[model samples]
Target chain A: MEIPDKSATAPDFAEPPVFAEPWHAELFAMTVHLHKQGLFSWLDWTAQLSEALAAAGKHHTLDGGDDYYAVWLDTLLQIMIAQGVTDDSSVQAMQEQWRNAYVRTPHGKPVRLADDGAD
Target chain B: MPHEHDDHNAHSLLPSEPALRVRALETILTRKGLVSAETLDEIIDVYAHKIGPHIGAKIVARAWIDSDFKQALLTNAESILGEMKLAGRQGEHVQVVENTANIHNMVVCTLCSCYPWPLLGIPPSWYKSDAYRKRAVREPRAVLAEFGITPSQTQSVRVWDSTAEMRYLVLPMMPVAAAGCDEATLARWVTRDCMVGTGIPKAPQI
Candidate 1:
């Protein structure tokens, strides 16, 4: 991703789509909710989200949802670790599961762990 | 019955390339410690259960009952909304477009999916699709038609494009059946599509 340096404004990225993917809402709400809980202040969230935006742009991976949320999820996880709220391994494991689920699911099914037998 | 084991699916453990890349960055960030799964789940649950388009319904109902509120909504929506304790969040600027006999409004973020999140909890998945973004602006009538709304040809079609600074909500024409209804009951008639200008509110059956 294009991690913009300090003093660099974000590129003219498209405004977030209004009706976006479920994952985007999940990431967006989680970010908002965490900020509300004082996990990180708005300033911290902005900087992190901005960095994610730039990075996603750099990698040609920013989409309306997937990459966008993925970047956001990474930023939140990173900030939490920086603040000692959480660690890398925990989020890493979770992300791995989500990623795996997303990859293996059919084109139109919910992402889930392969070992998860229940619907 | 044979023991049901998740048989070999070699690719099952692997994520999409983009997903892997994100996981890798996450790994790098917290190489030392971990964030709790509970935190993430708590946040997700709140959004899943608590938020939706109901807030927008309240605003629409208020506008219906009070002309002054409607005037305030059209002229100074941000402050008025703030007075109702809804200041724009995430750098949002909001405006409301009223549907009239001669004009029908629709909203699209041609550049992206900018929306009034404070009013409507989250934009639906369909709103963010490239198809809706590209086609809604160019062929709003056709798009609306697909949604089963065919505004008369004489009614002007106004398409509002959202930006990071500004977003829109459509104030649909209140139906005659709702004339004597209470605000909460009337609010029920205001669907999300009404605010997007693709649908009209239907009054309750007496």
Candidate 2:
């Protein structure tokens, strides 16, 4: 909704932004976008995220599959963006890209980001 | 047909769906070395800006203005946020750290993205970087420099990596000029870098 100054650092890059509200889908959407854009190879990302979780497991002395996945998603986006593979914009751009890349038919339409029902 | 959709939704919780298309791009970029700083900025401008910090600013503003709320935030973050009806769906147990000159804080999920979603809307682009994760804990000063933050001789920085059971978010100290400022105005000062403990909140130019 708000476009920060481009010169200003992205919250994910420089500072974490605090929100008065909760937006879980938004977070999921970001990850899905990066995943769509090919910032990190899925296999590499999955392995690293799993490793991050395994490391956390040692620290907390607990099994953290979901937490590991969440961290993986977070880290995947972070590193990929850092590496310049694809960013928040590219992730967001996936919608338009997919729309343009895929053709729609009368029976079914190509997947749009909002259509993560398939996800 | 509808049942098939439901079945997909059921399996969504499992990590089976490979997040196909994005991964392909990552492969290409990896081959091309396209994940540079400038390209990342452009990428976030498109996608991350869609949701992350725009939401985070409001949370920073509220924390600056409210005292009892701040104390409540410091302890039992999840329930307090739930009382405000802002607890995120997956934000299980969240914690807030106050960043001060004497002691600064940086958060990482050396393992994954275990962030305090109730307060900070989303983690930043760099927080997820392998270089950042590997270097931050071992070589924080160097990483902080990339974000333009260099601590003074007296300051000590502490980095915490969030795990599922415990997630962390930094409560950057409110600026003096920010006193009596409205939430929207105050939010402007809460830069994305500051929340991650990469930089200090900049003072207004005279």
RMSD of each: 12.3, 15.1
Winner by DockQ: 1
User: What residue runs in model 1 are displaced by over 4 Å at the alpha carbon?
Assistant: A1-26, A30-119, B1-39, B204-206
The CA lDDT of each predicted structure is 0.67, 0.56
Please, what are the lDDT tens digits per residue for candidate 2 over residues A2-119?
3334433323234333221122223344454555566545445545665765666555543223343345455656676787656767655653444433333122433333444332
Clashes of 1: 17
> Per-residue CA lDDT of candidate 2, range B71-95, in tens?
8888776787678676654435667
The alpha-carbon deviation from the true structure for residue A107 of candidate 1, after best TM-score superposition, in angstroms, is: 23
For each prediction in turn, the share of the native Cα contacts (below 8 Å between chains A and B) that it retains comes to 0.14, 0.06
Q: For each candidate, what's the DockQ?
A: 0.10, 0.08
